[model samples]
Every structure is written in structure tokens, then in C-alpha cells.
Target: MNIKLIHSKVNAVLKAASPITLPVDIESIAKKRGLDVLPYELGPDVSGLLAIKDGKGTIGYNSTETRVRRRFTIAHELGHYELHKEKSDLFVDKQFIYRSQNSPITVDHQIMEHEANYFASCILMPTDQVRKELEKMDIDLVSEEGIKHLAKVFEVSTTAMSLRIDKLGFF
Candidate 1:
């Protein structure tokens, strides 16, 4: 699946939903797509999983993770559902790691993982909204405090928000 196409699709969904709050309601979005988001005691290495059986799709995230991490995991599984469901009925995502945008993609699994990560980032931190938030704050992106504040506002981990800023070319 093309990362750009998935990003575009997510953007369209966000626009249609018109979320008016800080942390986007990703669970509601999943429910809208006929996905049941559930919490499970997955081990540390496993982040989340998406399973589709008998025309029913379910997303399960690690219940032991922090709320922010769980939110991202749910969004990531939703990405798999959006982009890779036609290819497979089951997807088990492990050890959440995002490849840099410039990194090489040498395998099909790498492609799917990268695309899902990008989808999660885009859905959680839309470019225009993040830019608007930064403009409103007038803060330095390089500063840790600024990143933390933005992360809190978006209800995402500092690492995730920082990566989104870098991907947006905010430096």
C-alpha cells in the first residue's frame, strides 16, 4: 500500500469527522469503520493486533501500556485495517518502531509497517492542525519543553509528537 494514499484517506476521514478537541477520538473512528477496539494483556514486545474473521474486524491493544501508547497502537492497527486488510486477515504488530521517511524499503513487510506508522502519525497529528497549534503557541520545536507541551496537547508521547514535527519539516 502507498503511504501517501493512506495518508490522504486518513486526512479525508479526519476532515469529515471534524474533531473539535485536542486528543482525537480514534476509538470512535474505529467504531465507525466497524472495528471493535479492545484491550488485552499483550506482552511487552507486542503493541497491538488486528484480526478479521467471518467478516468481523477487531483491534486489540496492549492493556499494560500507557494511555498514549495504547492510543497510538490502536491507530496503528486501524492503519493496517485500512491499508492491508485486503491482503491478509490477521496482523500482529510488535515492537513499535517507525522507519525514517528516507529509509530504504526492501521488503513487503517493511513497506506495510512503514505505511502503518505513517498512517498513525498522520491520523494522530494532522499536519495542518499541528501547524496551527505551533503557530498558536509560538514555541521552538527544538526545545524539549515545547515538544512535551505539544505532546500533552495532542495526547501522544513526546517521541511520537517529535517525529511528527520532524516529518512535517518543522525541524
Candidate 2:
């Protein structure tokens, strides 16, 4: 999948749902899309899953995970719902192993997972918002404290925020 295309798709969704406030609400967005967000005690390995039945969609995330993680999981499931729902009615996503940009995505499942991760990153830490936040802060992206502060502002895990910043070429 093309990274630019995924970014554009995320941008389109954001544009249609204009006036999105900071710390994007994953559950609210899912609800607006007519998808129910549910909490479930899924096993440790399973982060979340999406299911569409009878023309309705539901996203289930592991209740035991941290709030930030649950947020990302919901966004990831939303990605699958938006992009691959036509491919299958059910999508069960496990712990995502971060793949380097140059890694080979040879399988269909890997491709879809990669796209979903990209989608999650884009929506959770929008490029424009991130840039604006960085402009207001006088911290270095390479510093751990700076990453933590940014993560708190974005309501995401520090690791997720770091990856997002790196992907956006901020560091």
C-alpha cells in the first residue's frame, strides 16, 4: 500500500469531520461512523478486533490495556473497518510488531496490517496538529522528556508519539 495514499485517505476523513479538537476522540469518531465501540477482556496478544454483521460494525478493544493503547487499538480497528471491511467481515489484530520502512510486506495480511498501523498513526497524531504543538514547545524531539510531553498532549503512548514524530520527519 502507498503511504501517501493512506495519508490522503486519513486527511479526507479529517477534513470531512472538520473542527476536530486536540486529543482526537477515537470512540467518538467510531460512533460517528456508525460503529459501536466496546471494551472486552481480549487475551494479551490480541489488541483489538472489528466485526461487521447485519450491516452494522463494532470495534472491540482489550479493556486491560492502557488508555493510550486502547485508543490506538480502536483507531487501528477503525482503519481496518474503513479500508478492509469489504475484504472481510471480521478483522482480529494482534500485537503489532513494528516493521522498518524498508521491510518487505510480501503477504496480503501484512500489507493490510501495515496500512492500518499507518492509518492509526496518522489519525492519532495528525501531522498538522503535531507540527503546531512542536512549534509551541521549546523541546528537542530527541529528548525523552520532550517525547513524553508530546505524548501526554496527544493522549498517546510515548512510543507511539515518538514513531509518529519520526515518521513525519520531525527528528
Candidate 3:
């Protein structure tokens, strides 16, 4: 899908839920959405997948990643569910997605990954609320610690927060 469509869907969800955050139990969300989420061993080449069978939906993640990383992975797959389910049967992300950002990949893959990242960020840190929270700080917006704090508040990795903040033109 197009960015506009993805943006609208994410934005609508954000508007409906004013403040979002990570460390969120995405498994619960999946269950609520009629999807089952299970932990399984995905090899080094793959991070996760959105699987559906017999009219049921599910997500599978690598067992080796840290809890925070697993949460992000689930959210990323959830992004595919909300935004790209109609286009592809699966989204097999690689390990160290931050590195993948610099690798040679197809434009379509890049776009989809970026959209999933965007969706993850918005779900983890609702822009409206983050803006309000940041108003109390007088520090440089792009500084390392500033981004780190944002990551802490959102319970996402520093890389994810930095990417989201950069995309928002906040620094």
C-alpha cells in the first residue's frame, strides 16, 4: 500500500487512542484482534511472520531476541496486518533491522519496512502525547540522551525512536 493509506489508518488509530506506548502487551492486542501470537524459533535469516490458516490469524517470532526486540517485532508484524495484509502472504524481516536500513533492498521492501516502522513508532509513542511530554525539556532535541529518554518512555529501542523522531522532523 501507499503511504497515504497507511498514514490514514495509523493516524486514525492514534486519534482514537490518544496516548500509546511500548512494553505494551501486543499479544493481548492480537488476541483481541482475533489473531493468535506464539513464540517459535525462526532462524537467523528471519525475524517473524504473519500467518493465517483455517480462517485464523497468528504471528510468529524468533525466540533468540530480547523481550524489547520481540515486542518491536510483533508490532512490526502487526503493522503488516493493519497495512499490508492484502498485498503479501508473509513479511519475513531480517535480523538487525537497523542495519537493513542501509542495505541494498528493493524499493517496495524499503517502503513496506519503513511503513511498518512508522506504525510501530506511532503505536509506541503517540505523537500528540510525546509532544506534550517533551515540552518540559530544554535540551537539544537531537542529542543522544534526548532520544534515549524518548526510547525509555516509549519502551522501544533508541534506534527505533531516533528513526521515528528523524522522520517527524523533530530534530
Which prediction has more favorable TM-score, 2 or 3? 2
Q: Which candidate, 1 or 3, would have the higher TM-score against the true structure?
A: 1
Worst 10 residues of 3 by lDDT: 15-24
| Superposition TM-score, candidate 3 onto the true structure | 0.79
State, as a TM-score between 0 and 1, how close model 1 is to the true structure: 0.89
The local distance difference test score of model 3 is: 0.73
Candidate 3 lDDT tens digits, 31-103: 6667778888988767788875565668898888877688788878888788877777777777655345576
Per-model CA lDDT versus the true structure? 0.85, 0.87, 0.73
> Which of the numbered candidates is closest to the native, going by highest TM-score?
2
How well does candidate 2 score on lDDT at residue 90? 90
TM-score of each: 0.89, 0.90, 0.79
> By the lDDT metric, which is better: model 2 or model 3?
2
lDDT by residue (36-70, candidate 1, tens digit) is 99999989778899999987899999999999999
Ranking by TM-score: 2, 1, 3
